[model samples]
Target: MFSTGQLIFALFFILAFTVVLIVTYRKDKTIHKKNYKGFGWVGLGFTVFVIILFLIKHMLNK
Candidate 1:
């Protein structure tokens, strides 16, 4: 289970990423945001997705 602080940090992390992307796109023309997905993060994202779904199902069952 994730604590409130953990959730808040994750929210802030996403928000900071969005802000950074917007700021970089506006300030620079050729930042080159995306080329290809790196293996680690892609795997991590999928793992996180699965974990979230499992957590949801477990909570619902409870």
Candidate 2:
């Protein structure tokens, strides 16, 4: 069982960390958009490949 002070400190730490993370992401949003373009297509392709692999494995096991 944590004390009241420890609980308050934990809450404050989490809130501060979240605020900092949001601010950093907002500051870098433009750079990310410019640099990471087409990454989603790569992710999609990987996901599809994995699904196909699993389906093949399942079919072979039957």
Candidate 3:
């Protein structure tokens, strides 16, 4: 039920938000790399832990 003006506003808002996010991330890329080393492994471990938990839950439910 959005009007034409609302749709145009939303489009512009999304584009601007995306552009800002990209610019901000690029600016902080170096700092992020230095500070967040080993972050990927932590994320992987958490993911694996969650999957294992779900498997256990499923097995228990059966």
Candidate 4:
């Protein structure tokens, strides 16, 4: 039930926000590559840990 003006403003805001986010990520890409090399491993480890916990809980419930 949004008015035409509100819809237009929302579209413009989303476009502007997306452009800013992309530009900021591009600018920071090099810094992130150098400083966060092991980040993927940490994420993977956490995911595995969560899966193990779920499996253990399911086994104990049975």
Candidate 5:
């Protein structure tokens, strides 16, 4: 079992880490929007490819 001090430290650490992470993401939000534009289509294509592969495997196994 964790000591009380250890649990308190973890709680504060998590809160500080989350705050820092949100601030960092907000600072870079505009840069990310420009850089990662059209990224969703690539993800969609990859997902479709995986689904096609799974379907082919299922059909062949039948």
Candidate 6:
């Protein structure tokens, strides 16, 4: 059986990965679309929500 610490650690690992992805994506400015700004921000918000939900589930399962 997995331990609580393991679940928490995994959650943190995923969160770190998400942060890295978001930062990398934001820094990428090669695209010239004057209409994607809103979509981009909404996508980032979705990523954060998913991370938070995953963390909550991990904690609750313990």
> What is each predicted model's overall lDDT from 0 to 1?
0.86, 0.99, 1.00, 1.00, 0.99, 0.87
Clashing pairs in model 6?
none
What is every candidate's alpha-carbon RMSD to the true fold? 10.0, 3.6, 2.1, 3.0, 3.7, 11.2
Worst 10 residues of 4 by lDDT: 32-41
Tell me, by TM-score, which candidate is best.
3
lDDT string, candidate 5, 1-62, tens digits: 99999999999999999999999999999998999999899999999999999999999999
Worst 10 residues of 2 by lDDT: 31-40
State the lDDT of candidate 4 residue by residue for 4-57, as single tens digits: 999999999999999999999999999999999999999999999999999999
Tell me the tens digit of each residue's lDDT in model 3 across 32-62.
9999999999999999999999999999999
lDDT of 6 by residue, 1-62 (tens): 88999999999999999999988877765463554658878899999999999999999999
Query: Which TM-score value belongs to model 3?
Result: 0.75
Candidate 2: tens digits of C-alpha lDDT, residues 1-62: 99999999999999999999999999999999999999999999999999999999999999
Give the per-residue lDDT digits (tens) of candidate 1, residues 1-62.
99999999999999999999989877764444354437668889999999999999999998
Clashing pairs in 4: none
Which of candidates 1 and 4 reaches a greater lDDT? 4
Candidate 4 Cα misplacement greater than 4 A, ranges: 47-62
TM-score of each: 0.44, 0.65, 0.75, 0.68, 0.65, 0.45
How many steric overlaps are in each model, in order?
A: 0, 0, 0, 0, 0, 0
Q: Residue 6 deviation, candidate 3, in Å?
A: 0.7
Which segments of candidate 6 are over 4 A away from where they belong? 31-62
